[model samples]
Target: MQDEDRRRYHDLRPDWAESYIRLERAASLIRTYEVQFVPGLLQTPDYARAVLSVVHDDPGEVERRVGLRIRRQALLDAPGGPRLWAVVDEAALRRMIGGRELGRAQLDHLVALAERPNVKVQVAPFHFDGHAAAGGPFTILRFPDRDAPDVVVLEQLSGALYLDKPSDVEQYRRVMDRLCTQVEPLDRTAAILRAIRAEL
Candidate 1:
């Protein structure tokens, strides 16, 4: 295997760098539930910069991280790689992270990406009367290998937690299932996204 084939498991600071590398390597089907900003894989460059600058002050470092984020997303387009099924809260769509124009571009990006057969975008509306994913944002990574099992990633204020045990992973799986069911259907999500963009 080449260098990129290897999975590194640690990185600097409060970031879950190594876990993200594992995500890039092992995830054959990536399911994410985000209640905040857009998932890194789906974020526009400006949106990514806005999210990154919230923690880092240096423009140089922020750009470097943005490049890394954009690179990670390349996996979604790689041949025979993972297919992303992301359920984003409606709040994330309406947040206007970078600004109104950037927000509109982000919505346009999401709508365009959802057109891909492998990419599934579902919107979790506020009217669900509370749901299983109320805990917070997380990613459940499923690998192609049968023995690998699913890995659940939870980002915190300082660092991140990577849960690999069957019980923990199963719990997150259940939350993901409930989220998928509760969110608007794909077509409805597309319409909602367009509507949100218009408002922006």
Candidate 2:
């Protein structure tokens, strides 16, 4: 069943491409509910580089991709841009992707981002019991207009799968609500990062 669902959305069809266009235009607030790793918008250059390095064989191309990612993060900081909220799993903060120093830096970066009025950061502690999100990482992007359909992006080994179907989006929204309830409050999440920094 999982494989069938994966196959269904693996390739971006023409209709999916159109939906992506609509999503980009409609999105006014981006809420990311992440389970396996930190959201891309919160990743530091060093952290992103380390992640991309493992996948890209050519150093030159890897640098280009990292640069692009850094540029993309600017959208979150742009004036009058969409608000960003991210809920990350504790394991993401604990993962030593680029060693202790880089991990600490990344956590510190997330703390800084959490300070922004338009950005909210929450962390799901390891102590939480298994829930709907046990399936994997997913992101929900909301718009200012309630009438607009929400977009859900699911990540897999192959690529990103975007869900815009009303029923599918609603399902993910419910899952997000459950996950958010399990996470520590924003202030607590910041404290957790600080404690991790101290340990490093």
Please report how far candidate 1 places residue 37 from its true position, in Å.
0.6
Cα distance off (Å), candidate 1, residue 107 = 0.2
TM-score of candidate 1 against the unseen true structure: 0.91
What is the C-alpha lDDT profile of model 1 across 1-200, one tens digit per residue? Answer: 13442322113223476556656567899999999888999998899999999998999888877877777788888889799999999899899778899999999999999999889999988778887899899998899989888889887887778899999999899989987887788789789899989988
lDDT comparing candidate 1 with the true structure: 0.84
Model 2 worst lDDT window (10 residues): 5-14
Residue 87 alpha-carbon offset, candidate 1, angstroms = 0.5
Number of clashing pairs, model 1? 0
Backbone clashes, each candidate: 0, 0
The list of candidate 2 runs beyond 4 A from truth reads 1-26, 145-147
lDDT of each: 0.84, 0.75
Error of 1 at 1 (Å): 12
CA shift of 118, model 1, Å: 1.3
